[model samples]
Target: MSDPSEMSNVRILGDFRGDPSPSTLRLALAQVLPSDAESRPSAPDQSTAGKEDDSDGAELAMQKLRLYAQTAASQGADVICFPEYFLTGAMHSSWKAVRERQEPVAAHPNPEEDESHWLAQVAAIARESDIDIVAGTVVELGAHHIPHRKDAQHKTGGPGSASKESSDSAVASKTGLRLRTKDSSDLLFNTAYYITRKGEIAAKYTKRNLWHPERSVLSPGHPSSHPSPRLFNIETRRGLRLKASMLICWDLAMPEAFRELLQPSDSRDGPLDGPDVVFVPTCWYATDAGVKGLRWNRAGEAAVLDSLSMARALETESIIAMCNIAGPNWPNGGDAHSFQINDNTKDEDLPIVGVGHSSVHAPFLGCVGKVEDGNEALLLAEIDTKLLADARDTYRVRYDLADAV
Candidate 1:
């Protein structure tokens, strides 16, 4: 119930911004559930098709999230974050399939009429649990000007299709639909929402960086012509004020995205400092061939993901909480019991599913706490705001790099 705006009393001392009052925040990261089939309710009608299945999947996901939120709150977590696309599993299928599964954004005219009431339920859960919640990323459809590709029609045949003559026919046959160039009209975005303990939406961050496959479907938040980065200032119930920002999975790979949030902009009135903590809701995956070209024989891709998390925390001099999916690839058929939390299995013997290594990294201490590899569980870490203040004084990275291009 604390007013976030009233808590913004950061003082400007010489060249640096300082906060005299500092407090610790207990953070929790919830990995994706093992399987929906276990908790999913029986279908109303066996003949129900695509759209009905989508609805059922969304409902099941929400049910699991509610359970996680309740558990995190019971464990004394001040704020809990879910993995990216936790609601609809947007990246599990093709773009067209995602569009069918995604719920419509609440309209200003008559918000109650929207097909999915998932947002409202999320807010209610936050309020009931008395915990701040980052409700992962959602696929948002908005109108934007997208230029048409010159050979879009020809390229639609297939990845290796050379002949342009049968391009249209091949595309229709492969997808069971006609291929058409997208006009300068509507586009989709991967957007994350920050809900306060008061059950209100504090901020919304649209993903700026799109992964390779995502580029073909989703639009960038900061396109070439327009640039708008979002940040949030949250005041915890315990009277702790922290500057916070959000970055999707791929956004963590781009340093410039973090730089944009840390630096003060011309539009701001006073000197701006970097975020105290960065919440990353990711679905990062590593294959058998390893990430990029190099493979670290023993650690494999999970090590690569951890290295990125550590490097980002060290470079930014801030706390980083990375929440990732913890099960086998949903689209690809694989072991159903991979991410299950079994009491009989030893820690080392757990199945390595989706290379899950959800962790929390501190500016000074590299890895504060992390979930064991291949385990599906909540990773909690206590982040001291005073440590961040102390780290800035020792490193002076922000102050030294403030004027650098």
Candidate 2:
């Protein structure tokens, strides 16, 4: 059994609260790459377009990420958070194709061995730096040889389709594997995975809600039957079940989504059972973070972000941390190109439409971190975990929750 004192004092970090206690948490934002983006494309398809050159881009991105991680470590952050896909791109298709090959539900992770190697590298980075990492959604390849990957041994990533050959092997091998939500042939899961200090996946959260196009790529999490505000909890080796949970970018738009997440995972009766913090991971397709005022879909507007975040905070009273891609996350796969302010322009230089960027929203004040770059950027901060106490004070909030219950 782990000691009770180990998880009490969590040093929160991320880009959520504006004007955080600058000296308290020592927050550092990760300015990592979103995808294979060329700051200055040498005119047209004259660039390295295939998968081989992309490996080079991946290396460069990893290098930049290492530097950023080290920078944050040097600044004294006990925990560091990165935008979605700090190493690879946010879109799941790339991982699906690169790591595996599948058609719809039955696709197998072609490059099955790679995902573990990649995860090991990131875990090593976190361990060496003595920092905890909230790795952006990374695809996990299922081990089952069939079309899908599933079972207790492989939870979130499951089996897709049982191959005749693989099924025959399963029968001969006597490996009793039953599939649910996923199958064997390296199933792909859209998960916001939080790795603990021990470098193991503390908790794996398949996104509860899926956005347009993503529905085609990922599975939507079935809501946990618990009806409280706390969504998930990660008990540290020391026995501290930190109220850790994840909400993807598009899910932010649905206020009802928070309801499922708000329920506590702990069996305890104290306040500690409730999550003190929540992370919103996003790949902003609307605005260019580095390019300021420009947005891909002006209709998304600050109002939308504000409404989405504010409602959750006030109702849930949980500190929110949002990390978004700041630079040219072109195409759904970066097949197209867009720019942001950090490239060499000002926020006022571009039009406000079709140029949405990533931002962090806190309970008290919103818009803590805004990235105008076309890559990954961290909006690290420290939030007053106690802020949730205020939610009960809101007469409307109390009434609604009470009524709902």
Candidate 3:
């Protein structure tokens, strides 16, 4: 799967990690199916027993993560990214339930010393594999980082902004997870962590746009709280420097999210105007297309994913790396009814099927590499910065929007 032209630049010093290319980043998208035992809701257990089960589940998930990270590294990946909520699985539990089962981010005093903590374990795996990792997301409890702002507009701007008042109290109230004020000492968050090759916590991004279903369990990140951009920079094994950012599922549907990352900011410190690559970790399902009676058909959401990723790539003039959870059936023609979850259900069950189309997109090239089916697979691609430069030169998207942003 190596790009011959890009591979030619490799010095072939020895192993994959040693043969670095200054301009090409070997990106690996790990499309993994979470352990069903971990993702599924367990029967109510006694407090002591539940704690043991939770510990076991975390260990099991970490085993898979370490294995995959190693596998990706062996295959010459400078960076490997997983899907959203891949660590904790899409529990879809209530806030109270989540707070009870998961450790608060504040509670972890020393992630390095606490091997039981997911972040600590993932960080270790990054160091072991000697690869940078965008470790999907984990559901956790944490204090509100942004204080409540009454005049905060409650709205985000961009071409893909959700116009239907997604953050409106009335809408959020439907899930019963809405806070009276944005500030709270205790709250659940769907947080994504970025770990460097040395296992440093380079950056962390809490998802800003909550999927309708997620609103019931997690809080969205503050739109305007932090003046600086949520971004990080990485130098690959080949010395290809990349500026990147992370977004969770549903955020991809909002073009405004992309704009917020791509738009140049005088207050920012990263390279270029913004991120050269955007990593999206998602748990999106095939049944999450539209409201009942509104969807074109059962398979319509597949088109939504493909269209949105492409649109984001073309419009932003950058690389979009998307990795989604993989699951059994449906996208492979398994009956939708035979599988379980639906959007409107209150059961909060793990999705038995996913629209796993893990892919990488360049500005003009569209999808450079993709996993066509919803199955466990590692999608690798040679991301050449030259293509990004060429796309910007031809489109002049940056030039036109220079003054607008």
lDDT of 1 at 223: 42
Report the C-alpha lDDT of model 3 over 55-83, residue by residue, as the tens digit.
56656767767776776777788888889
lDDT of 1 at 73: 70
RMSD (Cα, Å) of model 3: 8.2
Ranking by lDDT: 3, 1, 2
In the order shown, the candidates' Cα RMSDs to the true structure are: 10.4, 11.9, 8.2
TM-score of each: 0.71, 0.61, 0.78
Compose the digit string of candidate 2's lDDT tens values, residues 327-381.
5334444322343335665543442122234554555655555544444444455
**Which pairs, if any, clash in model 3?**
160-255
Candidate 1 worst ten-residue window by lDDT: 8-17
* Better candidate by TM-score, 2 or 3: 3
Q: Residue 339, candidate 1: how far off, in angstroms?
A: 18
TM-score, cand. 2 vs. native: 0.61
Error of 2 at 78 (Å): 3.3
Q: For residue 230, give model 3's deviation from the true position in Å.
A: 3.0
Summed over model 3, clashes come to 1
